[model samples]
Target: MEVKDNVVIITGASSGIGLATAKLFAKNKSKVVLVARSKEKLDKLAVTLPNSLAIVCDMTNPHQIKKMIKKVLSNFGKIDVLINNAGQGYNSLLEEIELPKLRHIFDLDFVGPILAMQEVIPQMRKQGQGAIVNLSSGTTRMYLPGMSPYSSIKTALNVASHTSRLELAEDNIRVSLVYPYMTATDFEKNTLKSPRLSQSASENKDFGDLPPVDSPEKVAKMILKAVKTGKPEVFANPYLEKGELQV
Candidate 1:
């Protein structure tokens, strides 16, 4: 689980938690392949990090994901870590959703990660030891009214990670998940802004401020700690404080 010299592939690496994690990995001298649709951000990050591969990959597309995985493994020889950080979210009531947009969230949040996992697990198994860290949400633990689609899908992801860990454990592949509250990221401000969620969310704007959210860079450090330590999960909040966790 040592970070140094490991080849790690991180989806959604153009920004937010993914970007932060990429930088952290690079700082620790891990060769990192940064994946996302934005070539611009990826290129900039690569310029600053030695042994960083920035591939403009759209994870939702099966073919692109396969190509990206192949390219990374070819360049790095083995995939030591795969961090499933790319995802989408919806903010709306169940009744007011359009078919495609409704499905797109699950496609991005659930299906895309699974597809990426399917591609990488074999390589990880070959290595005889690897880790898959999934990025989930605190919304599944806490809640907000218009986040039904988001929270449900996020919950499903963690469940899948748990089951996946049990199945992959025999091969020495570790599956870990991270559940973080709202962190300051371009992700929220530039959300798909699904119209279906908007109409309902506007009326029920029940989003009262809770605890202060952390910066993505800070959250990413916690994720790296989990990666190095093989922790089952990391919660980016004081709520998982001293007295709250079960020993």
Candidate 2:
């Protein structure tokens, strides 16, 4: 899909991968709509990007999501791309994790993306072509002792993205997923601090040395390449490789 002149909405755009992608899109001349819970940061970022609109939204809230979509359509007239990047993680064993927190992670990592897709599908169908890019963790391919909740939800998201790709094929709407290998984002810090995670994480603190990770800006470039080349997914890492994949 062409990035230029496209109406793109990126959730979690206040920072990290979302923010990096927003900057790239804006530079490419796409009408970028930045969504996040931080109004101050979004407003500040929007000022630097041409044709950018910032919508402060909690992806977990249905009402706020609907309003965000309405606002985007009212401003841009059409939605060409929806990037589902707003998500949080919990660092605890499944048995040790609280039930409510697990559900909340599911709501943000799984449900919110699907809800946003639901809202945009009608418009995409009317347009006859569009794209949905979902951010999923590369950790799903491996394993982590204290990352069951996060990895499981991301696994589910990867499946949903694949299925959506098949279901939306005839409509010319592409569904793509980005599996980011341990990027140097605030994810680890936030996950460790998450209240839903067990206190054991804070007490024991066996985090060890941080692994070398990709920068958000580099991953953002990979994502844009995936969208522009009609690639179904991106395995973003230092290697920065691509392949035709379906699962």
Candidate 3:
């Protein structure tokens, strides 16, 4: 779909891919709504973007997700796109996984996006056409040690995204998934790391052989491509083809 003048809600808009996406959409003339728990950052970003709104929200909360959608609709009168980008990373070996932390990541990386999708569907349906771009990770295909919890949650989101695409096809709603390889971002710094896992990850030889890291701006362009082309999946890794994973 054409992004120009479209009302687009982007979760995790305070940083990384979401931040780049918000800026890119704003540049393209889309009405951008920045959503994140970082109130100051969102507010600051909103002010810099033309026709943008900042909504401080914790994506893990269903009520907050619902309220965010309502506010978007109230201000825009219609929803054109929903970008489910708010998520966190967790790292732990299977035996070392913390249940509470696992559950929190699950809520952030999987459940929250699904809830956001549920909240926006009615408005998208009312408009008779909309696009949803879900941010997934290339690590889902890497199957790296200490990444099971995080990758598994993203894998589940992959399933939801593709299934939603098929289910929403008749309604003229498009659901797309953007898979970003390791990008230069604060994700690593923010990730929940286990002591043992961190030490092991530091020694993992495989990481040293991986391709060059992608930038957030490159991933942001792939997201824009996903929405514009309505492709089921878009990859930020140049080494990857549509269905194949190189790393």
Candidate 4:
């Protein structure tokens, strides 16, 4: 989809990959709507980008999402693309993971994106064309031992993207999934983990053995390119020797 002169909504746009993507879109002259819990960061970013609006929204809250969509439509009149990039990590054994943490992760990783899609699709259908880029994880295919909880939720999102893509095709609303290999973002530092678990191994592994973590800027560019090209899926920093994903 052509981004110039279009309205693009990016969740988790306060920092990391979302922020990078928002900047790229803004550079292309897209009217950008930045959504995240950090009002200060959003406000700061809004000033830096031309034609950008920062909205403080907690994706887990349906009411906030409703107000967010209402506000976006009120300001921009239409949404051309929705980037579901609001998610976090939980690195711990299933047994060590608390029930509350599990529920929170599920809500943030899966339920929230589903609700955003529900609210945006109608507008897209009316417009007769739109694009949705959901951020899933590369770990979904790798299946790391301690990251099952986090990866599983993202897997559900991938499935939803696939189904939504097929269902929304008649309306010309394209849904794409982005699997970003470990990116050098603050995501891990912000992740929920137990105090009891030893962090040494995980911390060392993060900086060393795992596939080279792509920069947020790099991933952001790939995602935007995929949206422009109308690709259904994009995998960043693939682990395979061929380093090319079939999709």
Candidate 5:
């Protein structure tokens, strides 16, 4: 669970929680591998961190993930921690949501990480020790009107986290799930990218009111701390700590 000297792989590390965790790990003197679709961004970030490797990977593709795992194991020797955090949400009413868009959410938020896990776990298991940290949302505990699809897939991930934990524990591998409250990131921007949605909301569309969000950097720091301590679940914002915010 120590952050120092560990080889950590972070999916979706181009930005947001993934990027934050990469920077935190590098700062903690860990060897870090960052995976994302943006080559330029990953290159820039890799140059800034010592003992870090930036890999342009699309987790959705099984081939890309396989090659990524090959490149990591070849370069860094092994991965001690795998962070599955690349996901997007679909925030729309059930009636307005198209079937394709709904499926995309399930694929990205659930299937993508699962594929990455399947590819990397064997290497981790071969080493006889590893840790997995999954990114989840608080919407799993509450029904946010416009988030039916998003919450559904996220809940599926939460369930995967639990079952995967029990299954992987026998191998001396740890699985940790984090349900971070809304943070100031590109989550909504990514949500609007559902290909199945024929009619999209205007860029300025307002969704009445929602809970206040926090900074990605703040949440990223909390995420690293939680992982280092091996906590099963960590609330970076702890919005539910207050009675009114309870889900």
Candidate 6:
């Protein structure tokens, strides 16, 4: 689909990849709707971008997600794209992971994006075309010792996104997944660490060997490419040699 002048709503737009995506879409002349919990950051970004609106929203709340979609419809008339980028990181051993923290991460990483898709699908169906991109992690395909819980949640989203691609095909709503390797972002700083693990240990924990870290702008471009081509999958760093890295 053509991105110029299209209405695009991106959740978690306050910082990192979401923020970069919002700016890139704006630069391409799309009407960007920036969604996040940070009012100051969203407001600051909205004014700087042409034809942009910022809505403070907590993706974890179904009510808030619904309201955000409604607000986007109210302002833009039709929804062209929905980017599910709002999520948290969790790292803990299976035995050391706390139940409540695990539940919170599940809510943010899986449930929230699914709910947002539910709220946007009807509008996209009415319009007869749309694109949805869900941000996933490269770690999902790796067997990281302390990352199982987080990767499991992303794996669930991967399944849902792929399933939606098939189901929404009839509606002309394209659903895609973008896998990003380690990127320069505050993701690590905001990650929920296990109580049993010290701060330094969690920070210093290595993932064996990995590829070069990607930047937020690099992933943002892949996201834009996914929407423009309606490809089912896009990878930030394809050197992992995975067969799924096509497009």
Could you give candidate 4's per-residue lDDT for residues 1-247 as a string of tens digits? 9999999999999999999999999999999999999999999999999999999999989999999999999999999999999999987887798888888989999999999999999999999999999999887776566887898899899899999999999999999988888788899888888665546445655445656668999889878987897788887765622343333
CA shift of 136, model 2, Å? 0.4
The per-prediction tally of clashing pairs is 0, 0, 0, 0, 0, 0
lDDT of 2 at 108: 88
The TM-score values for the models, in the order shown, are 0.91, 0.90, 0.95, 0.94, 0.88, 0.94
Candidate 3 at 20: error in angstroms?
0.5
* Candidate 2 local lDDT, residue 120: 100
Q: After superposition, how far is residue 243 of candidate 4 from its true place, in Å?
A: 8.7
Task: Point out where model 1 deviates above 4 Å.
Answer: 193-209, 240-247
Model 3 lDDT per residue over 15-117, tens place: 9999999999999999999999999999899889999999999999998888988898888898899999988999998999999999999999999999999
Candidate 1 lDDT for residue 107: 83
- Quantify all predictions' global Cα lDDT against the true fold: 0.83, 0.86, 0.90, 0.89, 0.81, 0.90
Name the regions of candidate 5 deviating beyond 4 angstroms: 193-211, 241-247
Least accurate stretch of 10 residues (summed lDDT) in model 6? 238-247
Q: Sort by lDDT, best first: what order?
A: 3, 6, 4, 2, 1, 5
Candidate 2 residue-wise lDDT, 1-247, digit = tens: 9989999999999989999999999999999999999999999999999999999999998889999999999998999999999988877765677778888888889999999999999999999999999998876876766788888899899899999899999999999988887677787667733444545554355547644668999889978987887678788863324322224
lDDT of 6 by residue, 1-247 (tens): 9999999999999999999999999999999999999999999999999999999999888898889898998888999999999988988888898899999999999999999999999999999999999999987777776777898999999999999899999999999999988888889888887866545564475756656678999999999999999999898888543834331
Worst 10 residues of 4 by lDDT: 238-247
lDDT of 5 by residue, 90-158 (tens): 877777777887877787789888988887789889989888888988887777667788888988898
For model 5, the local distance difference test gives 0.81
Looking at model 5, the pairs that clash are: none
lDDT of model 5 at position 80: 90
